[model samples]
Target: MTTIKQDTDIPRTLQGLDDDRSSVRLRAALAAGTTPDARFVDKLIERSAIEPEFFVRDMLTWALTRHPVSLTLPALLRELRSQGAQARSQALHTLSKIGDRQAWPSITRALLSDGDDDVARSAWRAAVILVPEGEEAGLAAVLATQLGRGERETQLSLSRALVELGDAVMPALRAASTASDRRVRAHALATERLLHDPDAGFEFAIEEAKRVVALGGSGQEG
Candidate 1:
């Protein structure tokens, strides 16, 4: 168990960033994120340039993840505007992990025009998961559009997210099972029993229950 020490000295932690060893600087960024100070937020953004290590930058993301996602997302979006692909990629991966639906609109905008297929798929999936509860039709529309354009992995991710969306997704799920692509239809069928069989839902509800001593709890053995 790696217990993080509350770094009482800010100057000392900053000095660690200057160490000749890259690992030392990475650990410093990781520790600084957990600090009670907001100033470290600016420092992380600055170090984003001076630090050449991807792992270090990823650690910086992990540190930023500690803050309220609202504060970090706008900055990450700005990073996406730059020509540097690594920063844009790392930012998207970070946003996806935070999993906040509040960023759905931005994710949707990214998916709508992103030239890269992977980035579009990731943002599309994130948008589906983030849409507010009252917005199933909207979620389904976006999801269906993505399914229409997506590769196998994107469709699978959409299917799983739809399963989480529950009954609100049945209409779309039913439609997906009828898509022109056999692969899409097959993925839709993976979730079919839940839509048609009420007993299937009940079985899943207590799937972890102990083996029945007698089927249907009968008074007599079978």
Candidate 2:
């Protein structure tokens, strides 16, 4: 918990990030963010890619956001191409927190539909936050392709992302509500329900959708 002030403290702070104990790493990440030094940016990003502890990785992301976007953007964008899943997921998460539209181009289709659930969830979050105006529909269409993917948590992430697009996602949701895959139809219906009524919980909406789909309905009122 030492305070970071002098230039000499930089190297120690950098080393603390890689310390064996998670507490040391946590304090190091906190110090990096507190000081907001450009020198700490790269190291913070690198640690974010592999940090095992969720809290520490979150702190690492906070530290990255503390730096100039110009310094952090390129490095984070490079992380998207990393072979590591955590690397990609953490970078996307940081980008979403940064909320800079300039990072939108990096939210590629591949990332949106990434094979890894965590990576794809992160990408969905980043995409919704960074998607530019006049492109929500296209983004929603692409997001629709992911309906019925993964378990409940993953499905909820996709639903939330689609719901965030507002009315622009309606067409895609409607189309998916009739997909040959019942899971896709159920997910789409659940998402559409969430879109119209935000208070409807995902569990409730999805269970209702499943019933409707089972009865050969699309949850679309004719």
Candidate 3:
């Protein structure tokens, strides 16, 4: 395991995060979070936007969470508007982990429907986490627009996010189940199944929904 020795100088620590080795960058991120320095916030957020390693990016988010929201929130909110998809995704992810409602308004519909699947997925997760009280249904409506948007993983992510909203998503799911798009209706039906049967696997539900769609039948039929 690579380790970065404890250091007082922030620049050296920030530089460590950019090391060529993933292990070194991981250690640097861990060190930043372990120490919780405000000066490291910008570096951490910048690194998070472009970090190639998932574990390292996750650590950077952890590091950002350790800092004061007063500093991290504004930076994260700005990152949400960035052209880089990873930046917006990571910032949304960190904000979700921070659980700041003030950042809720920044979770825009454009982000929810972002062209990038990863960004849209992260936006869905973050929106579910940050949505204000009484807004779950509205958020679900927006999310429902992407029912058949991506592949299995993306569909599952959307399903989980909607399921996390509990009954609030029922209205949106119901509306989507009636969509003219077979994929959208199938996804909505499969999601509804998972919503009712928590033990049901998404793959099984989705496949069954597909079969139903192929047969020109509503997924409501057993």
**Against the true structure, what is each candidate's TM-score?**
0.59, 0.97, 0.94
What lDDT would candidate 2 get against the real structure?
Answer: 0.95
* lDDT tens readout by residue for model 1, 22-89: 89989888777766346565566556645678788778767777876667777766765656545555
Stretches of model 1 off by over 4 angstroms after superposition: 1-22, 36-39, 42-58, 68-70, 80-86, 96-102, 109-118, 148-155, 191-222
lDDT of 2 by residue, 1-222 (tens): 455345777888999999999999999999999888889988998999889999999999988888999999999999999999999999999999999999999899999999999999999999999999999999999999999999999999999999999999999999999899999999999999999899999999999999999999987776
Q: How high is the lDDT of residue 191 in model 3? A: 95
Alpha-carbon lDDT, every model: 0.59, 0.95, 0.91
The candidate that wins on TM-score is 2
lDDT, candidate 3, 37-141, per-residue tens: 778999999999999999999999999998999999999999999999999999989988999999998999999999999999999999998999999999999
> Candidate 1's error at 132, in angstroms?
1.4
> By TM-score, is 1 or 3 better?
3
Ranked by TM-score, top first: 2, 3, 1
Worst 10 residues of 1 by lDDT: 205-214
Off by over 4 Å in 3: 1-7, 220-222
After the best TM-score superposition of candidate 3, give how far the Cα of residue 59 lies from its true spot, in angstroms. Answer: 0.7
